[model samples]
Target: MSSPGPRRRGVSVPRPGRGWWVPAWAVLLAVVLLGPALAPGLVLSYDMVWVPDLTLRSDFLGLGSSLPRAVPSDAVVSVLDEVVAGWVLQKLVLLLPLVGGALGVVRPLRDLPLPARLVAVSLFVWNPFVAERLVMGHWPVLVGYGVLPWVLLLGRRWRVERRLPAALPVLVVAGSLSASAGVVTAVALVASVGLGSRTRAAVAVGLVAAANAPWVVSGLLHAAAGRSDPAGAAAFALSGEGSLPAPLAALSLGGIWNSEVVPHSRTGILAWVSLLVLLGLALAGGRRWWSRGRRDAATLAICWGVGLGLALLTWASPDAVAWVAAHVPGGGLLRDGSRQLALCVPLVASLAAVGTTRVLEWMEDAGAVMVAAALVVLPVLLLPDAALGVDGRLRAVDFPRDYADARAAIDEDAGPGDVLLLPLASYRQPAWNAGRKVLDPTGRYQSRDFVTSDALVVSGTVIAGEDPRVAEVARALDLPTPDERADALVRAGIGVVITDLEAPGEPPEVAGEPLLRGSRLEVSALDGARSPAPPTGWLWAMAAAWAAFVVPPVGVAAAAVVRRRRRRDTP
Candidate 1:
């Protein structure tokens, strides 16, 4: 493999010098594209579930676990709600990753001219995959997607220089915030080490494992509890409609199962265009790697190869995907293999940046700018409707006043036992949400701790977890006799039964007086069994694991800052 020589009108052209302006321009472009998300009101959608009433939990530190994914975004949302009354914080939390991802894509192109760098950033951020994920409400994975390139960059520096970067811990924490992203980051780190120093890789791995101990411990506890669900694993296996081939989806980066999120007419066009651009750039990058054998390029090639290979396997082979999901710990976390294709985004973006620079060198400055501008704007023009709100499909809307009132009422009346939310469904079509797809918002609105029977829905099937309480609750609701139902509720340690009045059914006649009756909700107190608390040892163990994950990263980051300051003062 060799770098293609730049030629223009039969004359050779020289490469441009590195400059800081390209990154600054890339940041500006990202902010402009993602600016709408920063609007004043909540942008509600399927998985982008943010409510002002949601509170932080200590279990958020548990790595390789579900709760950990919401921790980062929840922190931001909570803080914003306390300081401000609008959706500005939620929007910023969502858009921050896009900005980081844009900068990550452009940063490696420091050697390239401004036009080419901008084109690469635009293509990376504005692609169909990003748009689809945004619509699907997987912003945490997107955050991981944004931080990945920087993680690789920092990991490479550590491997080569034998000194960890100050930002390495932060990047690791960001990347590991989501389970899918954590798996990708762990794999990338090991791969980066294989390409460089084994000793440095071991040290880096140790620190990462320490930082992720909370989730790892939680995962271990989950495994010990025999809570694994094979049906859930199989349901999450990668497969696509016959219309879109798995390989093409991997290349084009658009295998979203939800048809509503994808633009029907322009999907094929965007897919093919992205496929061709990425393949061409990857070929060029591969050639450069073969010739020079640079560690960075090799690491990127490995990432692209792994991401593409896994995506293809998951998408093309159902049995293989199911097998992996069942056998591989935490594999079930990635219900959509298309999300893994995000790893390829940065690699492709980097190659595209190089390709853009190469193509520009063959033309005059003005011609290069024109070509770059067209390339940068092409994806956006093709998928014009795939912005933050999916072109108005996901507009911001306020929750009804009744929701707040119900939450307040629950806080005042509910006992230590959990509130049982009715309808026992994983999803809801709330009247207030404008018919948009959303997770059950009862979890978000209730002030008292609550439980819902909404098992994780996959492939239109409700895959039940180890908890039999949801099933028990469903049975209790069907007992026919009010006394039996009341006894069942008591046995379940349910202090209050909150029924969604908007949930398309008449309220069940229970034995107790209605505590709070509103247009949207009805709450009734249940007297029977008390919910048992976990053993004291379990709580302490979780706390210890959380401390392990948090303390070292803070210390390392502080030490790095102090060392830098002391060196500066030495002058």
Candidate 2:
């Protein structure tokens, strides 16, 4: 419960008059790390897709025919995109973690010297975990990851005061941008605000649970909630790039499943050396950090242990993982195992700071202060490629002009019947995006009901898609004769078809003559469509679920009103 004060005399990284430099340094680091990601154009890497105009749709709320993997993040973006430009919103989403994380991570460690706080910021923001997640375009996860340390800071205060932080709901909601983000945030909230007092814990848990309602209610109401593809468990399991052991790789915060996202230096000897140094530093700090009666330390330690343990479960026991994924509703969310590793970040950063402090104190030489100052940017030195938008892997690119033209052409003739994206793929490796894999943006760009594939092909293995309509559409399109295919598609509600030339695969033989053709896109209108009406059964449920997010604020407002009345009455 007591702060470990400074280990010895303070060493100024800049000139430690005040701690103003902490946040300023964080902003600078964010600018450097997110160089191209903040450029004029949108960042459309892998899962991070931002369209010119994102409209509110059934899909955004998880009521679409396809899987709701994007869920509330898509919904949130659509809401924000109404006022803010898509490109700017994308930058904020990208910058939230890198900048907010540095600010959050240093809050608890302010008791330490300025140098130690700088070390925490650098380690927390510039590490492999943050880099890999950024490159892979999991911005929502990064948002939650950035919020973890702040949760810790507030949790410590909550425990001491026996009253919840007023900002807890806001923080939890911010963290719950996506289902994965929601899951992690809820776990963290529970861990940080433990059941020391039943009433306080209940209040905290209820608010946090309400924050997660968007995904929780949607996932449970989903038809496939009880069943998920188990094969993905093996496909997305965490590994050490086949160079280091899984545990050490995870401990070092480097083992992401997507080998392409892992920094080039991660496989080299320097990486191993860095990992050993990090472990040594953590051990050095843990002696002082993980002592008796400190609830903050316990919360972080529990998180690290549980996070690493679950991250390893998929690797250590594949069969068990497969069973769980198959049997549990929304268990497939955990298929990408490294997501759990996010919980390890707050603890590790703190340890690194305390460890740096102890190290500086131990080294009695005058130059030791100078040496400790260098530790602030050690994360950057160790993982140099993480800067400058992951070595230009995440450069912002404008959508080709054809996309806008196609959307307009399709919109004019688009009736009740659904539009189908041709070449029938979930991802597009567009040339404009430098051949980077991005989720097809056509659906969001045009405010229409566009049906596309959700199936993912990892390596050579094809994981089955969640949308049952995709297979039916594919079957209808694959009929023996062009006439038969066209007739079949028309009767089943294929209104307009848009084909992307940049994406691999030819347009359907049944696509007939193009209504509007561009260099990269071709739109064809189909007639005599009879599309089935979208299910409206879950609308009330979803509305109620969304309403839960509002309840906490209402409660807070009511509580404040009551306190005012009590003061007035006493006087």
Candidate 3:
């Protein structure tokens, strides 16, 4: 094996302070990519709903009647939005990952030259995987993907130095924002930080479990609430984008099931070019990476192989995966196989960086620099549509004035029942949002328990949701006459009904004068209902789990502070 050195022949590692260019370039690329999407209003897209304020409730903590897909993510936002505007927080959530991901990908290849670092950052921050997930509005998933490199570094630090990373627990918590995020994070953590030392392995296990506790506890708490339809496993399975085949698509990191979110560029020649570049780089740098990062290479193999296998299984053998999702508790998370593909990123970014360095080594100074610069720009040319708000699918828009009016009217009464939305649909293609499809934002917009349809309809296929209360509420809406309907809704625990003016549905009438009426919404109160339920004992358990997940990282960070102080004082 080659000896470790700061300056290797033909490779040009960065001098200290000069490395600022890496993250600055990453931030610049992110700005170019996000473009208009970073404007003042909320950037609402598929599953990416942010409101002015989110009411903290048991439902937000996964004590809801349905699944905990948004669990700690919603809860986290609730806390953050208080300190920051939701619009600004949304932008930060979208921005931090791209910049952070670039830095993380560059960390492992610190010994490599500028060409290598630039290429890794470009590919990591601006690729089909990042593009598709961003357009799909899976912010937490991107957050998880961003943290994988740090997880790898932690494993290496422990393997070589036998020292636990102070930020180890923090990284896991960042990655474990959602159940799917937690699952992929766990895979990366285990693959990179295998059970070599008994003590480290034990700590790793505890960290993994603690990080995953929010979603796991939420899922278990609501386990008796319902089960997802087995059919979802097939519906959400990874598939080829446009004309590309599934396997090639997977290898190229371009297979996301929802074609709507895919950039138009992926449907054509850029796809093949990306595939070629990925394979060429891997082959070119494979040897160097193998020599330097043997353990990392093994971890990469496990992660990529397992990720690809699971991604394909969801497409080819949905029946088997569907069985697991049906029979296993908290297994529905595996239904979206495309998420696991995040596992393939660490090695790709690392190898691509070193590959550029190796390729540059063959040419003289001027030629090599130009080639490296061209490679840095090539990722942009290949996926040009990823920039400017993902081909303009992502743009900021303010909520209708009626939303605030309705909330204010409802806020005054301090009524009993949970808020109920009209139209009874799970997803909304709101006119206010330029007809972009989003999970209804009303639930998060108001300071009340807003019950919405749990079922999701994708590509004309309806995947039943877990909440049985959705059915009872739907039945209440079907009752004859305004009085009977109002009575049924109140008895069924609907405190108020807020109907969207733009949505296509006949909102049931209430006998009394409406509380608030506007161009966009009609708010009516049901007089007989009781106020929202108080916090159950389960909420304390949920809080404790979140505290457990967070406290270790706090302790570690505090200890680091103390040690630094002691060293300074002695000197």
Candidate 4:
């Protein structure tokens, strides 16, 4: 499996000095791209508050949140096991891939000029989506996506040298672990390596499939469990789910692309301008790059084309989205469907980076320094601090003054493992920063996310207007219907009821005690019901598995360092 030498079809191969600019350019690019994210002010704190709300509920209820019970109580319990541990762990997860990527690129870094290394690292660091993941505490998804380029780099190295045993397996595992984002990451990696021979591509595909087996198996199990509906396959080809205007609804989403200044009335000139620029670049250089000149760029274009096409198809036809969505292991839980755009953002950024790099290189070659500088400045001028920086808006979880006061009051009355019934929205806010669990966590409105086979317990399907078991649970609680069932939830040993507005019909307060009260939220405690305890067996098993998974990679890397040293000495 000898690697091919660089072709001369107007492509810039990694020559000793010529490619040095790539890394430096990449970093500068990252800084610029992330400028808005690192900017001073905050935007709307929607996601931050929301995700933690799920965590808080899970902490109290022990798999009681809307998320599937099988989602591993460890996921939520991990939030409470250590003091301020969750945030620290999340930050580390985000950094791991970038660090791993740097390690993976060591050989290439040494071989390439300093400038190229700088540019490459910079490009990776400045990627807008990557920045977003780090700031938002999307540790799992970010770590998955972050390790991707390194996997591609390793795979490419293996393809060139036939080091299949090592790199191939690593790529597979990386891809599987990143199941949701990894799908796109795998697509990008494969495309990045498309510059190699066809035989290599075949092997890579096979290896990728083998590695993704875990995710595949998980999906199968979910489907078998009736969490997914196979009937949705027909939706993929069906026409008229909505108009193009429907897909464009992302325009209404605030906080993306300095929407504050741009004003996302769907008529913002800046968005239109950005689109035109992207289109013009694609039209101007897309075909030339795709032709035989730069195979990697061509492959990237195809990957982006596929992702975008799939996104649009889903938007246009629910059937299309539903078909693919249903097949995905946890796909049914995702309602936005636009979340697929999270995949597209990086692909688009990479393409834009390539385009930027090429255009600037062309300008420099033509000695148009002033024009090139202006070209760079235009992007700088157009993009704002909010679009690129760590503004408060990006912080999804922040305790509002009123919410904080209420939580303090409640904590005085309640102990650990108590349940609360309040507006899901109130719980959605990041203010309930208690390291313990709450009842009825956020994001449970989905179908497949929560379930229990026990006749006494109801699954998410039952609660989310789907499963019949929900009605049963409602009746058992002495409530006639689902809505009343929610109101009646307090009687089921809810230690607290926190809400701004009281329910219309006064069923009278619980006999327990008033925990806390603030302007908007209220916290009440229940009198009876046993307090919850830790799952000793589950915790021990999880801790053991966690240790097993973490130890070997570290040991292997250390052993490699020693082995290389010994070999060098013997030689």
RMSD of each: 3.6, 2.7, 2.4, 8.7
In terms of lDDT, the poorest run of 10 residues in model 4 is 451-460
Top model number, lDDT: 3
- Which candidate, 1 or 2, has the higher lDDT? 2
Where does candidate 3 clash, by residue pair? 416-530, 416-531
- Specify the poorest-scoring 10-residue window by lDDT in model 3: 1-10
The deviation in Å at residue 230 for candidate 3 is 1.4
Off by over 4 Å in 2: 9-17, 511-513, 553-571
lDDT of 1 by residue, 103-124 (tens): 7766666555566667677777
TM-scores for all candidates: the values are: 0.88, 0.94, 0.94, 0.59
C-alpha lDDT score of every prediction, in listed order: 0.65, 0.79, 0.82, 0.40
Candidate 2 Cα lDDT to native: 0.79
Q: What is the per-residue lDDT of model 3 for residues 1-571, given as tens digits with 9 covering 90 to 100?
A: 1314233456443332445779888999999999888999998888998898877887887766667889789898999889998889989989888888789878877777776788988988888888899888899999999888788778667766888778877888889999888878888888777878888788888888998888788778777664568989888888898788878888888788888888999999889898899889888877878888577789888888888888888888888888988877777777888888888887788888778867877666677778888888888989999998888888999998888888899899636778888888878889989999998888788888778888888889998887877888888777887888878778777888888778876666655448887988878888887644535777787887888777888888899889889999995
* lDDT tens per residue, model 2, 333-380: 777778888889888888998888777776655666776767887888
Tell how far residue 355 is off in model 3, in angstroms.
1.7
**Please, what are the lDDT tens digits per residue for candidate 4 over residues 315-368?**
466564455545555554332233234434433443343344455444433343
Model 3 clash count equals 2
